[model samples]
Target: MINVNEVVETNEMIEKENLDVRTITLGISLLDCISSDLEQLNKNIYNKIYEAAKDLVATGEQISREFGIPIVNKRISVTPIALIGGAACRTKEDFASIAQTLDKVAKAVGVNFIGGYSALVSKGMTPADKLLIESIPLALSTTDVVCSSINVGSTKTGINMDAVRLMGTIVKETAEATKENDSLGCAKLVVFCNAPDDNPFMAGAFHGVTEADKIINVGVSGPGVVKTALEKVRGESFEILCETIKKTAFKVTRVGQLVAREASERLGVPFGIIDLSLAPTPAIGDSVADILHEIGVEHAGAPGTTAALALLNDQVKKGGVMASSYVGGLSGAFIPVSEDQGMINAVEAGALTLEKLEAMTCVCSVGLDMIAIPGDTRDTTIAGIIADEMAIGMINQKTTAVRLIPVIGKGVGETVEFGGLLGYAPIMPVNQFSCDAFVDRGGRIPAPVHSFKN
Candidate 1:
């Protein structure tokens, strides 16, 4: 059934476009690692993860050479630490100790990052969830290669403003703790609403309790391929543009499908899902903002930008779903400012604002990401920003998240460089107003009536 032209076309997409598999994540359950003894808990945690993911990187590399597909990152995700640690950890330091174990094992296994240093407190914080939240600043600062996330809201649970208020302070503390490193620790932390269980992406990926004991998830990304394909129809109608993108996305996801199955087979792990997220990087032409431009935006934050993004996101799913039977994770286009140079330029040119970016998230995959705020920006203001985005995800019944960095000792008009895939960003200003009273209410924003569909 395989054809020569299909192979040729895929090769073109890979060689010319920046088409690549963004990540191949191994999701491992750690519920078995729970124990009352802190030392034994850390040991179990380390041994379990290292054993599960020991061959992941080597397997990925071997597959890449065989298929000529670039598998960008080999990563891992475990059960939320709070759930298991609740039974073991007596204090915040205990949680950080677990984070250290995660970091150490991640490096040993050659994984770029290990996720699930997380707490799910959508409805409200359990004592363990609160402990993990309190430990995040220290946990992230003290460790490398470990990412953290907290789910503060969900459609079924509404918004947890109590967690929101606390996360604002935690986000600030994380940045402050890593100020010597340009507040890089915040880059590894994400706060979300309706977080997905099967996400292969970092800072948000965690092995949901419902998943299998071991599974492999693949994230495919190709914004450059899409933008390049659009060149054939420079002045074409919207219908033609949509068709072109769908076809390009099809090629992108097909590569991911091939890689995921290959990796799974080689490693003896079951394939979970193919995340069709068009993850961009600092590399030129691999920008989602450029895709918006190719979709006919003068620049990213223009009048018709949101509409253009909505079309791109919808068509990508349409094309991707046809290519893979199982599609999960944040599959829409990502507009990470630091990672996408076009996004950074949009901000510099004033084509993008914090508010405009928020609107774009309504139509895109994940919400406000890699945005830098002024050091003087109030913690309450950060909480207010997260609350607004959470409200969107809650009302729309979709996943949205915030990974904001309050650049310490740096104000607006200044810049901070995180290097590597996490490039650099200008500190965008936030509203001066206060929402202290509203956020300080310390209660849940009840789930919508539509969420009662059960």
Candidate 2:
């Protein structure tokens, strides 16, 4: 056990570096479970996931208790359902049923969420893709832990307008179906460009084609630890601050690597990537917004937030890469609007706006996650937000996503409760400009020019 002096040192390092363990995800590939018979396929999937992750939650809890640090989330990601059910299901019902089975396995194992009820429709939709999209609302509404995503854009294939349009309707439907929770179900759906296959994060985590049959990925988070550490080191020079942050990130990511190794070894699964995204929680100490405030922003989403995030991202990636050779996913800061209490407070106080958040995404890991908008938000406006994020990812050749909630009957400044994990968000307003012209030019935007350097 670490002594009080060591604990003080750890806290100092955490505050100075803005470092914490974000999440630890177990990836279970379901391709082998695919069968012509729908029931057989579902059964195979359930057995595979259940067998692979039965001890995941228990293992995580044990590690957290032993380490004396919090492991924020324990999650599972599986092979994209579109491909897994391609040979079995001919209709949307099959997709819904498959998602239901996945959700059941997740709950049974005590995991917070199960991702990969999703599709990669960047170029075009397969028969299975269409069905998967259609069944997403039903799947998410009925299941407590199921999350979905659609990859409609990539640097190689550009953005698929048709698929994007379909997702707009899907998001609206998902929100309306879960209207009692202020469109919380839609908060669990993300649209991504350059989505990672081995991501251990929620709403957008799915095992890609390149992934092995089964693997363990860890995302470590400790915003509270980071915040506490930052408070200790007052009036440091910028270079000193950067060095401090890098060292702190190194320690946090090392802890993540340790947990990942133990979990993978015990589970008899191949070790996957460690995503170093600084995911926030709703607690007071566990906040990315508080980190910003500690960094002299005084308020999150303020003028200095973007520059601060840029520095934070660079320092985190440098430290995480040094800590683990297997680092992947969006390995930087996450500024999800609803999940962090500071962010919700800022939105409610009108200190954070959509435009400022967009700028922050340029420097953060993902874009516009869990943002709540007025109930009357136009579909075109939602599409515009997604388009902006995809464009950023395509041009920069990085992964970015948007998961915005259009709360029913809630306008700007109103609050919506999404219960545990999803949290609550204050409704934000969007620009009222007509994006119909841009959205109507609905052909596939070709891959970026710089994508062919190889």
Candidate number achieving the greatest lDDT relative to the actual structure? 1
How well does each candidate superpose onto the true structure, as a TM-score? 0.99, 0.94
Question: After aligning candidate 2 to the native by TM-score, how far in Å is the CA of 307 from where it should be?
Answer: 0.9
- What TM value does model 1 have? 0.99
lDDT of 1: 0.93
Question: Model 1: residues >4 Å from true position, as ranges?
Answer: none
lDDT of each: 0.93, 0.84
The total number of steric clashes, by the backbone 3 Å criterion, in model 1 comes to 0
Model 2, which residues run further than 4 Å from truth? 1-22
Model 2 lDDT per residue over 166-188, tens place = 78778888888899877778978
lDDT tens digits by residue: candidate 1, 1-454: 7699988888887888888999999999999989999999999999998898999999999988998888899999999999989988878899999999999999999999999999999998899999999999999999999999999999998999999999999999998999888888999999999999999998899999999999999999999999999978988999999999888888899999999999888889999999999999998999999888887888899999999999999999999999999999999899889999889989999999999999999999999999998877788888999999999999999999999999889999999888888889988988897899999998899999999997
- TM-score (C-alpha) between model 2 and the true structure: 0.94
